[model samples]
Target: MNYLDRKYQATMSVHQLSILLQYSNQDVFQLGNFVPLTALSLPTIIRAAKALVETGFLISNEKDLTELSVLTLNTSFNSKRINVKVALPQSSKPQEKEAEATCNTLMQDRKYYMECTIVRIMKARKVMKHNLLVEEVLKQTQSRFFPDVQFIKKNIEALIDKLYIQRTDQNDEYEYIS
Candidate 1:
């Protein structure tokens, strides 16, 4: 699953994250592991490493110069229902229930992106009917994931309640309030 959740606000760039994922399951890792990756700069790797620590994804340990800077995955980070994907060897597979749990978490993460897209569309349009809003939201988000129709309706209802939008007297159209 992608770790693009806006809630986490990852300070590390995608390449840095790729470097971090290289030692996903290892108990200890060295900073040198990132050197072979020609695309990323050393400073970027170091910043990403520090950001990961700040984000609670990794725990670092002081090490001798003979060894690469030691780091370990923070096990506590996984317990908060934040599913971070660690690369596993081909022979090992996650259990069925664990995979399902990951999927559920991924869906929730996508919902945030969808919500932002809807706001952008609605704020631009100012006023739109239910069907038109749904259509536009789907069309604009076609490159992303297909949203559930019920989910869109629920979001519309929520927007109305929050006064972000208002249902018109016609009962089918909504006008942006803010």
Candidate 2:
């Protein structure tokens, strides 16, 4: 069998063991519990349980496995093994481009938001000083996000370039082009 098939089988064995433990009324697993709660055949449960016991994730009383034999979960071993697995990096796929795309999209969205906020404030106020506009933008957008002054200034320049607003004689004040 391939490595992936073996891994899948091992994962399924662990999954089945967990389901059995969760459904069983008593701390120990019994044949009667498996028969009523799950559609899995008796042979399948026995095989998985035996595999779990061999892997130190389960304990069984019988030297010879059987449907009637009781089994217990080995929680410490399970936790230790899980911790070891978590400590190991699972970087099977390359993710750098995905992360870069996400970051680029976020930056574009933020820039759009800043531009919209500047336009909205200018439209409402008709004319506003640069410092006041920046403060108002910060106050209005703070709940959604805290924007940097430089980014806000950049958006303000973009709005001017788009002819949505214009700088007044004072240079610090902006007049909405309406």
Candidate 3:
């Protein structure tokens, strides 16, 4: 299993947590079945440390030189790790409301197009390598929309130009782009 799965399954005792916070050597000590703290396993330590902070036990003295040194050493050991920080974007109330409205409109339009018959046909034939002959594609289109072949062809061409479908030749066999 991955680190995330292991973390989810972790259940440490209060004594183990206290050891981690109180002893300097505890920085490298094994806690339960956790992996040893090393260059390759630093993220696990960082995650556990953050969990301690979340539970109000691991307070940092941001202005302390010793704290800065520890942080610098930890960062150097885990150079490739990423820390996820989520923050809401700063925007005026009206601008935030407008953005939400625009997102809703786009989502609704996407849902409408997904239910359209033409989209279904395109989705069904997404893996064809060559252009499907007009006659062959028309038979499938007929079952869905009952439109004339020419009309279906025009609609297919428009969809292709709009990047919804990919057409490889003069004939109408098409594939969905997504």
- Number of clashes recorded per candidate: 0, 0, 1
- Using lDDT as the measure, the top candidate is 2
Candidate 3 differs from the real structure by a C-alpha RMSD in angstroms, to one decimal, of 15.2
TM-score for each predicted model, relative to the true structure: 0.45, 0.53, 0.27
lDDT of 1 at 175: 82
Off by over 4 Å in 2: 1-89
Tens-digit lDDT string for candidate 2 (1-178): 1211122223444436444455345556775457556667776566666666666556887876687888776544533232222111223343677688899999999899888989999999999999999999999889888999998999999999999999999989999998
Please provide, for model 1 over 1-178, each residue's C-alpha lDDT reduced to its tens digit, 9 standing for 90 to 100. 2333323333446755786677555646776667675366665566666666655676876522222577676654543444443332122244567788999998887777677776788799987888999999889777878888998887777666777788878888888778
State how far residue 30 of model 2 sits from its true place (Å). Answer: 34
The better candidate by TM-score, 1 or 3, is 1
Residue pairs clashing, model 1: none
Off by over 4 Å in 1: 1-94
RMSD of 2: 12.5
User: By TM-score, highest first, what's the ranking?
Assistant: 2, 1, 3
Tens-digit lDDT track for model 3 on 90-162? 3377678989999999755543443254666667766454334444555654554444556555666667777
Candidate 1 lDDT (Cα, whole model)?
0.66
Worst 10 residues of 1 by lDDT: 84-93
